[model samples]
Target chain A: MKNRLRLLAYPYILWMALFVVAPIVIVVIYAFGSAGGGFTFDNFSRMGTYLPVFIRSFKLAFEATVFCILLGYPLAYILSKESSRSQGILVLLVLLPMWMNFLLRTYAWMSLLENTGLINKLLTLIGLSPVKMINTPGAIILGMVYNYLPFMVLPIYSVISKLDYSLIEAAQDLGASSAGVFRRVIFPLSLPGVLSGITMVFVPSVSTFVISQLLGGGKYMLLGDLIELEFLGSAYNPYLGSAVALVMMIVVIIMLLIMNRFGEGEEQAVMI
Target chain B: MRDKKSRVPGRIFLALIYIFLYAPIIVLLIFSFNSTNSRTVWSGFSLRWYEKLFNDDMVINALYTTISVSILAAIIATVFGTFAAIGIFNLRRRWQSPVLTLNNIPLMNADIVTGVSLCLLFVASGTILGFGLGFITLLLAHISFNVPYVILSVMPKLKQLDNNLVDAAQDLGCTWLQAFFKVVVPEIKPGIVNGALIAFTMSIDDFIISYFTAGSGTQTLSMVIFSMTRKRVTPEINAVSSLMFVFVLILLIIINIRSSVQDKKLRAKPA
Candidate 1:
């Protein structure tokens, strides 16, 4: 009976092998195989042209991750302290915007950050000159931060809310300062959530083609845009695109591994 | 009074975060009703754009396709994934861990990579299958990405199942399959439902993967909006977006309320 039950998983296993595992092999095949249909490192060799793009994508993603940490950590911390009823409501509010179609959320910013957007209109009405907010790296970073902040907050909040209140009480009774209690006990305990949050925010921010295009106005070419350009956009080169994607996959895996090694106790915090 | 006074900063900080999160959505909502053709300049509010969205064949077709694909993908993935989770749960630890790791690929990989890789797979398979990328491939891609989430959601519930429950049903003279249906299905129904819900939510909101696998022959709502966005301004998209926002908002609210009520009942139960 047990064997028969385990046999039920075989069909799904076959499905995943075809859909999930095979495609990754194909990505590698295309990445390494040259246009002439022979194995070559030419695709990777050609990545020099996109060196600036790689740098800018990582730089911007890093900046956005930092911003999310600064903005989200406090929000999650405070949210952890709220009454459970209000906590549910507030957490929903944080997540509701994310459930809006990804494009719609970015498109929301397109209207807000444009030269004649609502923000600019507000500025002008107040007798201030309109600022050029759209089609810049800053706009792209802002878009990344805006879209992924909830990814950061939700993990941290889940971790912190479940923290042992008795630990804090013990620290306070032992004469630790409130700041020291938070710094030593709370922050250290919440590191898993923080680490997972960094992974969640950074990966998407780095790999986002839409946020850069819609917000950066095609002026800046990040790794995502570069990959898109090869596959679906103006440039029709999947080999080079595969190379870029492979590089990104490796980088992301390495980052996640390092972080996982540090504190992934609540790594499942991300599924929330 | 002093304690409340000291709490003002955290409250203000949270308020500002909320504003940052909502300001863009509010802008999109406000523009959806703009009377003038322009998205930037707001005249008196009008329902013209919403009316236009209703009349627009492109938007309507995309919406139809989007809903169809999401529903199909969610249901199919949930069925396959629930069985897969049960199977994995019963497997030896050695094989189970490897399969679980494989399951994380779709969730962990960047959407673009997943999209591009799947696009390649469909194109390659189409050569032998005599079909190219289209609605079928699009639906297939949605199901593929959604299955991992379903498996993840259901596995926990399967683990929570009582060890003696299945045996108890079998000893009562039910066939193994009958025992599973009679005993196990009811136990894991919540998980199956949760998996389906997550699958649906992920599918409906998906763009990047769908954008690639969908091909030129088909379009999801995300693809349509993306095309509209290429232009400087398209007020119809704003109207459609506002509607989507409200629809999801309502759906989420209902789910949230139901879950909270369930939580209350669970808590109220005597231990």
Candidate 2:
């Protein structure tokens, strides 16, 4: 029975090796190997030219992550304080938009942000000047925050809801001010969720092509857009695409390591 | 009085956030019922887009592909992941962490990276052994990405399970297969179901990976919607989005009700 049970994992192991491990290995080889199949370092060196794109990607992703934290934390805190039934319903409400196709959601934003769109129409009706919202970096950041805010909220909400209210009460009883109690007790306790949320938002935001493509109107080029262009656009080069992907993977892995450190080996709870 | 004042601000803040989160979806839903195709103008209420959606072969094909691929990927990943979790749970402590870390790589890695890497692999292999990229490669990519989520979801349940029950069942003259089928499977059924649900959602929501892996001829709903948006925004796509939103919303409501009932029953039991 033990042997049979052990044998059950063989298929999974084989599949992982062939599909997961081998593809990554291929990516590495393509990143380092020349088009003629000889080893070369040109791909890595060529990445230097696209330094601006990389910086912009990280900057936009960082800004988006900050916005998500600011907006999501309060909502998550309030939801955590709700009755369990309302908590369930409110969390579902937050997550329901995510169930709709992300492209559609972004498209909806595109329409609203356009010059003659609904928002501008509303602004005109109210005697306010219409602001240029589309085809800008701010628009891309808005799309990122809109699409990935749920990722930030769910983890933080899970952590905050699981927190023991007694700790806050204890801190207050010890003559701590309300702000001090939150700073010393609640904020410190929720760091793991915050870290996870940051990674959850930043990683996808940095690596997204679709959001920038739809919202940025092709005027703004992020790292994702650059890598995608290399593979599928006019300057189609798989080797360079692999190199860019390799670099993005390294950055994401570093973020994951930081997340794991803050998570302290119990990261599964934040999956909600 | 102060508590009430503070609570009002928090409630208002939450309301504003909900509005922010839902504004796009509400806009999409309204447009889905609009008579005119223009997004800015309301030409009266009509279900013309929904009617057009049903008649569109391309949209129907993409929908079919998306649903089938997600279901297939979810089932296959769940089976493999359940067994893998069991096997890893039974392994020596030293080996378990390394195996789990490997499992987390795909989950932690960016989708664009995974998609590109898989695309390279398929292209590389095609040159060497004539393997091609299309629906099969897309399905494989989905399954590979989904397995880790299933493993993560199931491993915790496996840990909480009592080993003694399985041992007792085996002692009652049950074979290994019988014990596993009757005892272990039932014990971890919730985790298995949860894992499948997560896998299904992940597979269905996936776009970047499917975009790269799906060669020119194949398209998932996401890929179709993406291309449609790139060319021109169509009301038919809005109709499809509305249907998908309602479908998932209904599914989630059912799941929530069932779980709350289970929670009530568990609470009613004596400790």
Q: Tell me the TM-score of each prediction against the true structure.
A: 0.96, 0.95
lDDT of 2 by residue, B8-97 (tens): 888889889888888878888888999999887889999999999998899999999999999999999999899998887777677678
lDDT of 1 by residue, B1-271 (tens): 1267767899999999999999888878888889988778878989998898899898899999999999999999999999899898988888998898889989988899999999989988999889989999999999999999999988998889997988998898988888889889998988998999999999999999999999997999999999889964678888888899889888877887898898899899966
Evaluate residue B97 in candidate 2 and report its C-alpha lDDT on the 0 to 100 scale.
Answer: 85
TM-score of chain B of 1: 0.94
Interface RMSD of each: 0.9, 1.4
lDDT of 2: 0.87
Give candidate 2 misplaced runs (Cα > 4 Å).
A1-4, A255-272, B264-271
Q: Which candidate number maximizes DockQ?
A: 1
* Number of clashes recorded per candidate: 0, 0
Clashing pairs in 1: none
- DockQ of predicted candidate 1: 0.83
Return the top candidate by TM-score.
1
Please give, for residues A53-85, the per-residue lDDT of candidate 1 as tens digits: 999999999999999999999999999988787
Query: Where does the lowest 10-residue lDDT sum fall in candidate 1 chain B?
Result: B1-10
True contacts kept of 2: 0.68
